[model samples]
Target: MKFLPIFLDSKAGPILLIGAGDPVRARLRLLLAAGARVRWHATDGDFAVAGLDAVAASRIERLETNPGAADLGAIVAVFCAGAGEIGVTVAARARASGLPVNVMDDPAHSSFIVPAIVDRGDVVVAVGTGGASPVVARRVRERIEALLPARIGDLAALIGRWRKAVHARIPDMPLRRRFWERVVDGPIGASVLAGRSDEAEDSLQAIADPSAYAGASAPGTVEGRVTLVGAGPGDPDLLTIKALRALQDADIVFYDELVSPEILDRARRDAVRIPVGRRVGKPGIGQDAINRLLIDAAKSGQRAVRLKGGDPFIFGRGGEEIEALREAGVACSVIPGITAGLGAAAESELPLTFRHEALRVTFLTAHKARDASSVDWSALTDRKMTVVVYMGTTAANAIRDGLLAAGRSPETPVGVFARATRPDAKSVVGTLDHLPALVREIDGGPAILVIGDVVSHSAPWRNASPTPLFHTFQMAAE
Candidate 1:
């Protein structure tokens, strides 16, 4: 990020404002509303607080001295608008003093850029595009303004007032946080937001044991649990709302190697991230060890998230993890994601099921040749069944041999889609007879193989020219 978003304490000290015109006026009002004392040097010498309140106008100290020589000792920040060359000079001076400065519409001369603000009393949202696009920032601010509750700030103020009491009642840090979470998510916070602060206060005061209200087993102990989140097909946007919330709430995350960095970034900033899943050819912390980690994390009162790529239930070993967590008496829940097969199909426009041509869709894995050989290929030989093979890159030949040997036609269309919904995703399409060759054309694994007549209807299949292998296979069949 070009600029870090921060809420500067406006009451810390006076802000030196140097400028004129509407932009300066707008910034002046913003600073005043934020309760900042302003030392104004209106370059045009019109220091009129025409529309401002008497209280706010009284806070502004109009400076007759040249702003370039003005003492910046007690100033916390500097803002320049319509000051032109003088703004640039003052910006350089502020930077030398190690103070944050902003030259309106000029990021090159500024240490900080003002963001579009969504003000909800105590709850303020700042939307910034790093000075690249103010319009975009404003647009984002509008969306945030719409989503935030009108009285959400009132809820924050209530929490602030009761924070010390809650802390005193629940000394354990985790347990105390839980207490506030319960208040904010439960009826007490709702009452405050619904314009019944008195009722909310009474309800809160009536809670005999805040620890009990916060779901603490003992006076100081907090309950911890595991949330198995499905990170969908390398796309952060594809994550389920619940999955995103789980990530945001997690104290620690044990993520698969296939989970994209973008998806990992969704987790809470302070969350402890550990890679536990196996990579392409490298072994990982074994599943048993991973389970132990999860159990231990929860037993220690930390919210743990097992972030797996794609849908947890779809060949993701989610069932095994669930069983392990259950046996360990750890509370756990799952949030499903868009699996790689479905992601690949959607991206490539490869219909897994088509009316009479492809009726059934079977998802299987062939991580190695032995795995492919052991598969019940006979059952998958039906012309109308679409077979999606996961982790089949290494066992491509084995898959072709097994399917062809089981009377699945070599003429069956197939598409090898790699990286699924990721930006670098690639697809190769041809007859099943050239399945191994098709797999070879892809850049890497974490790819899926779609086998069925319906593959011929995919975008890649239609767009691709017939390869020599496809031509050769067709000739042999002819």
Candidate 2:
């Protein structure tokens, strides 16, 4: 909004430098480094300035007079420094010649201003405060410099080298973008950042020509990988950046019933989506069918993504899928997300593990394991431990009975966070005895049950605020 930022073609022609001062010398170094030819124009016989040694000085062409249209036509931009009245006249001439002109220490009379630059070779970042505050811009540039790895530019250059080859190999734009994304965000990019150019080049070569480099890890070969991604609770905002990348890079995505539509929308538009089962009793597509689909997709050299709600490794049955993929010789990885319980706890302002309050947290799936009585309910009766139950709405009665039978008091405070972190999310606070009643109120759409003393102390369950948003946390009487 302040100033239109553009990278001029320095190689097109020479950049005219008017006057010989400290500013002029600094601009010369930048121009030379950017591969710009410079024509030095000065009235003084001694055209020397500080910092420029014999080598850089000899490269500059000395111009006797102020540059006319012919000279301006041969140059990309003009930099004037400490010329006083003569400098103003030179700036006017450069502007009349239709060349972008910069007058040092005066932005009002200039068409362009030199920015505080963070130069990382091929990757250059320019920060300008519209000539308002150079110090502020320089400070911001320093922060960015610290954030970016020293070898990031090298990584970029490496990718640039393979750009043509990648385009030739992958004709499709979407697939090409995905390939590059994997290269930059995946293991290849990591290798480059860590100064492992050799490994990065090898990986890049393998991707470019799978047939020539058939190592097991070679990406686009007959062998493919399955990335298990957690979509987080119902809110797309809660999804991790890594999870989003996995979806965008996926050739096919197998999602759970609890996975929200918004999260699925983030995946590549052309990606094939298969709905796998996660609903309480609704038997959608079985797990065996899902496993076969993933294995088949990978074996055919297509990247597969298994999108689950909350943390996949939590109650999402990710271990089972991992085991199946491993058995079929398919390479796989997991990208963890904010689980339903954690997201719910945050939204409700409930601390799962508070000092001197709740010392430990436990996550348990309400859906009984193959052996119905396998769960050690007694172990979960610790007063200091907070218990979060996933998919527990349907098994509310069963959960209450088990906890009560395990000698846990019926007066134990419990909170139900339904559709946690979503805009339309709701929560209920009540005693263990009221668990089944609270379950009845919920529509059974991805809920997490939190039990412990912490539940009563949370913002949502305590004194409800007058705002409609807080009304969702409907409290039941003792």
Computed on alpha carbons, the lDDT of every model, listed in order, comes to 0.88, 0.79
Q: Model 2 Cα RMSD, Å? A: 9.0
Model 1 agreement with the true structure over 93-146: per-residue lDDT tens digits: 999999999999999999888999988898888889999999999899888888
RMSD of each: 4.2, 9.0
Off by over 4 Å in 2: 1-220, 368-376, 464-478
> What is the Cα-based lDDT of residue 143 in candidate 1?
85
| TM-score for all models, in order of appearance | 0.95, 0.58
How displaced is residue 60 in candidate 2, in Å?
Answer: 33
Per-residue CA lDDT of model 2 for 1-478, tens digit only, reads 5898898888888888876666666777888788777888764544766666676666789777643332566767888876666667778888888889998888977999989999898899999999999999999999999999899899889989988976776665545665676677888899999999999998776654533233334444445689999888878877888888888778889888778788889999899998875566557777888899999999877789999888889977899999999999989999999988998898888999888989999888866533214668999989999998877777788888888999888888888888887776878777887888876666666788898989877877666543212224642311
Clashing pairs in 1: none
* lDDT, residue 441, candidate 1: 81
Candidate 1, residue 446: lDDT: 81
